[model samples]
Target chain A: MKPINEMKLEFVSKSSNESFARATVSAFIAQLDPTIAELADIKTAISEAVTNCIVHAYKSSIGKIYITVQIFENGKSIIKIRDKGCGINNIKQAMEPLFTTGGDERAGLGFAVMQSFMDKVRVSSKPNKGTSITLEKNIIPRFIKNGQPS
Target chain B: MDVKIKLTGNTLTACIEGDIDHHNAKEIRECIDQKIEEESPNLLELDFSKVQFMDSSGIGLIMGRYKLMHILDGKLQVINIPENIKKLIKLAGLASLNIIKE
Candidate 1:
């Protein structure tokens, strides 16, 4: 799809970068003038996706994490976060809540959180290749008290 | 994340600031856990008035603290949860479990 606006960011798979990635995406999406609630949803979903890449994909060792965001003229958004590390063997089980492999520290709710916040989440992975997560959110157009689009 | 603990009587209130994610959840967990061990308060209150962002990791942080308080025969309460963060907590079914007091 030809995006009216797009951004690509690459960073090392480190826990600290999770916040960075979320902030970057949130700032970029701010151009749409989304509601604070909508902005929070996007930031939280991005945080979960980036954290998954750091904890599950990279697993402590540093690797590359790529984030691509595209916004269409209609205010729809598509965000893709990819990691070239250990791929998920079972996407279904992995998406289940409270089924984490990152030990007690992890709540195993990353994918579930993503699914809850975004309109749609699609995951693709190969055993040894890598994992890619695509998130989509349909923007809720804002309106003024005059019953007109802001 | 920055954590400040206030102890009054048997209640301990922890004021947390900044974002909560996997990177700093461990640190936040350890900080609060250490205080719980030291004070052994009967009530634990998590103040999120200053928290601007949180994710699933925040849920895990609260869950870990709740279990700890339960083991100690204490109660856990979450106060001043912003609407956005509250949504994530509810999504985790924590509200249904009554683990968090709004």
Candidate 2:
């Protein structure tokens, strides 16, 4: 489906940029006028995706992470996070809750959180090429008056 | 993320401020672990009232601390979490973690 609006961003796969990515995506998603809860969900999902690129894909080595956000007229949003670093060998095992190759500092719940917060999540990768994660969610429109839904 | 440690009696409270993410969780974890080693508190309290944002990295932070405390025969408790965070923690099934408290 064609998107009503779209944006793309690319940056170094640094851990610090994790929050940066979230803020950038949140700004673009703001055009949709998401509720606080919906916005938080998207932010959390985006953080997970970006962190995966940093920790698992690039392994803390410098690499490029690309992000694309598209908003649909049907109150839906799709955000794609892509990395050219080492890709996943097993998508299924990787998506499992509490499954992570990143020792110690990782909870292995990146995929799990992405799955939970978004309506749909699609992951694709090539072992030597790269990996990309596409996340989709619908924002229900609300009419507000005096800070309450009308 | 910034962690402020306060040791009172045998309880150590680590006030976690700022955002918790993979990037900063590393530093916060290291700092907290170092303090835990130094104080060897019987109970470690992770106060999150001031945390502005958190993702699964926050969960990882809690899990790592729980494991560390378990190994040291110490106890860990997470207090003053926001509603959204409490939901996420429940989704992670704190019931299974046993020692987890909100």
Candidate 3:
């Protein structure tokens, strides 16, 4: 389904931009009126995806990171994060938990955490070309969730 | 993110404040490591009361610190974690660290 509202953002793949991206997306999706936990889940997923673009995609030098967020009438948020940098050679290995090409400093749980929070997490990459990650989740309205008048 | 170090003889408590993410994890790790090397505390406690946000980098931070403390012949404890952050920890199967309130 086409999005009811959408946004596109482009920024240099800087670690500092991680928080920037998270905040921007959170603010934009605030219209959904998600519960606190739902918001936190989306925020964490965004942070992980952006961090991957920074630490893995553009490992050696800085590059551009593209992000698109689309909100649906069904209360689902679809987020796509892409980078035109070093792509993963083994997508399977990269997605495995506790697997890190980035070494010990990385928990290698980026994909796992995103999968845990979002309803769907899809990753596409081409070696020496770039990588793109898409995340989707539906936000349940508070009134329906609580099943009672406030 | 920043850490306020409280050294009381053999135990060192790091009161972390701010989001633990890829950008800030290195700084926090280095700061805590520096303290561990200097003080040689027998126990290191990571206090998470003030932290408001975190991601997988939080898991990495705790795992790396756990290894660090283990190598130094010290013990590490994660305490005062808010409910949300604790959930992330559990999702990562870090409950082995005994991070849940005891």
Candidate 4:
């Protein structure tokens, strides 16, 4: 599928990079002129996916996190976060609310938050192979033009 | 992210600035926990007035602190949370867990 706009970024799997990754994607999506709420949803969703890569996928080991964002006309976006690390053995269990491998430190709400904020969320993983999460959102402009809701 | 704590009598309020994610959630938790441990306030207030963004990690941070405060016989209050973040806190069913002051 051809994308109207696309960007790809690769960085080391470090916790500190989570904010950077989020900001980059948000900035890129700014061209779509999304509302503050819409943008926050996107950023929060991105943060969860990248955080999973750093905390669960690599598991204290250094690895690479690849993020690809594609924006299509008609206010739609597709975000893919991939990590080449220890993969999930049970995607079903992992997606369960309050089910987390990261112990008490994790709220186990990452996938839930993603699902709530985005239109669609898909996770594909294989043990020892890696995990890839795809998130899609349709950003409807919430602004008004000419003193009327557009 | 920046965390600033203030104490008034038995109330300890920590004002968190910037986005709350996995990157800074640990730090936020550690710093706030240390303050709570030292002061043992009757009420721990998290001021999100300056916070612009947050995710599940933020929710986790609040839940963990709620547990800590509960053990110490204290209550947790969330103040000035932005609209979007406030919606998320409610979506996570945290409204039943803490005091969310609009």
Q: State the lDDT of candidate 1 residue by residue for A15-115, as single tens digits.
A: 88988899999999988778889999999999989998888898868999999999987779999999999999999999998999988767889988899
Measured by lDDT, the strongest candidate is 3
The sequence of per-residue lDDT tens digits that candidate 3 reaches over residues A26-107 is 9999988898888899999999999999998999999999999999977899999999999999999999999998788889
Better of 1 and 4 by lDDT: 4
lDDT of 2 at A150: 55
Off by over 4 Å in 2: A144-150, B98-102
* Residues A83-105 of candidate 2: C-alpha lDDT, one tens digit per residue: 99999999999999989898876
Q: Each candidate's chain B TM-score?
A: 0.95, 0.92, 0.93, 0.96
lDDT of 4 by residue, A82-125 (tens): 99999999899999988998988789998998999999999999
Off by over 4 Å in 1: A143-146
Q: Which DockQ-derived CAPRI band holds candidate 3?
A: high
Q: Each model's DockQ?
A: 0.82, 0.77, 0.88, 0.84
Query: How large a fraction of the reference contact set does each model reproduce?
Result: 0.75, 0.70, 0.80, 0.85
Per-model i-RMS: 0.8, 1.0, 0.6, 0.8
Q: Would you list the C-alpha lDDT of every candidate in the order shown?
A: 0.89, 0.89, 0.91, 0.90
Q: What TM-score fits each model?
A: 0.96, 0.94, 0.96, 0.94
Candidates sorted on lDDT, descending: 3, 4, 1, 2
Model 3 residue A15 CA deviation in Å = 0.7
lDDT of 3 by residue, B1-102 (tens): 779998998999999999999999999999999999999999899999999899999888899988988898888988898977867988888777664444
Which residues of candidate 4, in runs, are more than 4 Å off? A141-150
TM-score of chain A of 4: 0.93
